[model samples]
Target: MSDLLERLRGRGWRLTSQRRVVAEVLDGDHVHLTADEVHSRAVERLPEISRATVYNTLGELVCLGEVLEVATDGRAKRYDPNAHRPHQHLVCSGCGAIRDVHPQGDPLAGLPQGERFGFVLSGAEITYRGLCPECADRG
Candidate 1:
């Protein structure tokens, strides 16, 4: 946590109470939280924190490559804090639950050069959609 704070400070980010609370809420593995969820959790520690502040902090974290913004289903973007490694996502189509998953191979390797269309493709996102165990059992 101190490492993250130091990195943020080195990047010219102001270390405010609201930003600290938001960062604390986002520190963990497999954490995928929406801005509202982040605000709800941050309020538990700092009641004065505003939703806008949480959103702004999240945006800053994303810009710093400290977090990943996942936009699945064209709905609210979920913020993922597992930026230490490259991976993919597995989404529960029924309940909107998300989980980080490692694909069998390099996802980018599947993109052929012909599809590049003379454009340089730097990255790709692969999301596997299926019914989660709980949702599958319910159906």
Candidate 2:
């Protein structure tokens, strides 16, 4: 069983065949796949699986806080299974490839009280953009 599957099971989420396949497809590091990408992979394992099922399962996962929806560079949203972990993203500006980055310190700490406009902060998201080695090599 993958970490995602384990977590879902722990949360008492039903593990149907379609949902299992979708979860398996998302079980990996730096895995940031769009819904279509996930459906493509799920279809390989479960040919009977429909795109709608994949989409619905992804939506449920996101709502359950089991997956993170990432919209980078105005491109299609990607589903990340590293929700339980604390990390941000490092996106390759050239290819749009994403990697998980665990930077030091609290990101919200840098925000000055005056700049906050008096709203309480719960969390923050920071995306660092640069070229990956493959993209840099191509450049």
Candidate 3:
């Protein structure tokens, strides 16, 4: 996480206290959190941080390529700190939980060239949906 901070600092990011707290909350594991979730967590560390600050920090991170914005569904978008890696997402239909996954094969190749409709494709995402183990066990 320090590496990320240093990179941002080298790029002229101010690294304010609120931004630092937001970064701390985002670090570690394959964290997929919404802005509200981030704000909720940030409040635990810096109770005075506002939702607007967290949102702006997250947006700056996204613009800097330090984070990935994932829309697994119609709900709030999720922030993924594992932006430097290539992976897909697995969603729990029952609980709305999200997981990062690396599936085998090139998903982009499956799309026929003729169907592209002239727009150049840069990347693709696949979202697999199903009931998680705990949710399935509840049946």
Report the number of the highest-lDDT candidate.
2
lDDT against the true structure, each candidate = 0.84, 0.94, 0.86
For residue 134, what is the lDDT in candidate 1? Answer: 99
Look at candidate 1 and tell me the lDDT of residue 3: 46
lDDT (10s digit) by residue, model 1, range 1-139: 2245555667787777888788888877678889999999999999999888898899989998988899988878998887767788999999999988877887777989898788777777888999999999999
Estimate the lDDT of model 3.
0.86
Model 3 Cα shift for residue 87 (angstroms): 0.8
Model 2 lDDT, full chain set = 0.94
lDDT of 3 by residue, 1-139 (tens): 3246655677888888999889888886668899999999999999999999999999999998988898866878998887777788888988788888899888888889899998788899889899989999996
TM-scores of all candidate predictions against the true structure: 0.87, 0.96, 0.87
Candidate 2 stretches greater than 4 Å from native: none
Question: Between prediction 2 and prediction 3, which has the larger lDDT?
Answer: 2
Regions of model 3 farther than 4 Å from truth? 1-12
Candidates ranked by lDDT, best first?
2, 3, 1
Residue 97 Cα positional deviation in candidate 3, in Å, after optimal superposition? 0.7
